[model samples]
Target: MKRQTHQLVLAILADLEVYLKTELDNVVIYDDGRGNEDVFFRITEKEHLPLVASLVKKYNGRLVTLTPNVIDDETHELVYHFDIEGLLINCTITVTDKKIPSITPILKSADWTEREMKDLFGVVPEGHPNPKRLILDESLAEGVFQEYIGLSDAMAGAATNKLWEHINEAKRKRD
Candidate 1:
């Protein structure tokens, strides 16, 4: 990350922070201190996601990736990684809601990412155009995070086998 790019990102983030505070409550920003990497901001209010997405779009950022992190038993952190002008901004929203508004309406790249989150976390992407399965099999249950309970022995064994087979296939293809 160039010094100029770093400063530019910081400035944009600072502006976003101020804006976020004014528009939404319980927003916290964390700087990883590793230059141009690993910055996180958490939005406590799920309703504010659309506004956050709008701000990211206004800054000409592209939604790079979205990840569902099982933070705790009742909470899942929906991390929306956005890249703007060579800077990565990770906006995380801790969700307990069964559904959250879709950002794909604003960021076209969110289409598949939102669906993937829904499939994996069972976090419904409300208003998503195509909220279909991404990588999960129809037979396997959703929200089956590795650490999650209620995972049956048979299902776990089947998944482990499928995973190994998929990994071996990729290795074979590469070879």
Candidate 2:
């Protein structure tokens, strides 16, 4: 019975692919904790996001959230994470020449997710109207998040120097 249900979902996705225009690069399906099937797919740049949303609507699937991740390379690839009805679908799209396609036009919910990706991964959504810093503030030390990741491996002098810089900067600003 479970196998049959999985096959049915695959058929639906395959049908959606024809209209999607781009070939489905990859597909991953798993059972989410909520007893619904979770599906992830890597697809080409054809802008099938709204189609996916429509599928979610037809299936009564909830639109959970969207997250974008950056792949560090000469041409960074943007991975969009979509959670629909407990199923996580990750779509990876390549950006050549630092040009990222805007999904906010398709899904209004993609606004903030694009902003976060911009600040953290340096991937700018081309059509995002209000792209602003979401992670760091004015007072945050440059590369603080990156530095925090390496805090455990930082040498004593390096740590102290960074700390002193912050302290002196604070003092200088106040004085």
For each candidate, what TM-score against the reference? 0.70, 0.61
lDDT to native, each model: 0.74, 0.60
> For candidate 1, what is the lDDT?
0.74
Clashes of each: 0, 0
Best by the TM-score measure: 1
Task: Give the alpha carbon lDDT tens digit for every residue of 55-77 in model 1.
Answer: 77888878999988876766777
For model 1, the superposed segments whose C-alpha errors exceed 4 Å read 17-38, 137-139, 146-152, 155-175
Q: Which tens-of-lDDT digit does each residue in 1-175 have in candidate 2?
A: 2233565567657766766855676677777544567667766553565566555555555434544433444356656666544455566666655556666655666777777666655566777777667787756543232224454545653656865776788889979
lDDT of 2 at 117: 64
Candidate 2 backbone collisions, by pair: none
RMSD of each: 9.2, 5.8
> How close to the true structure is residue 3 of candidate 2, measured as C-alpha lDDT?
32
lDDT value, residue 64 of candidate 2: 48
Clashes of 1: 0
lDDT of 1 at 65: 92
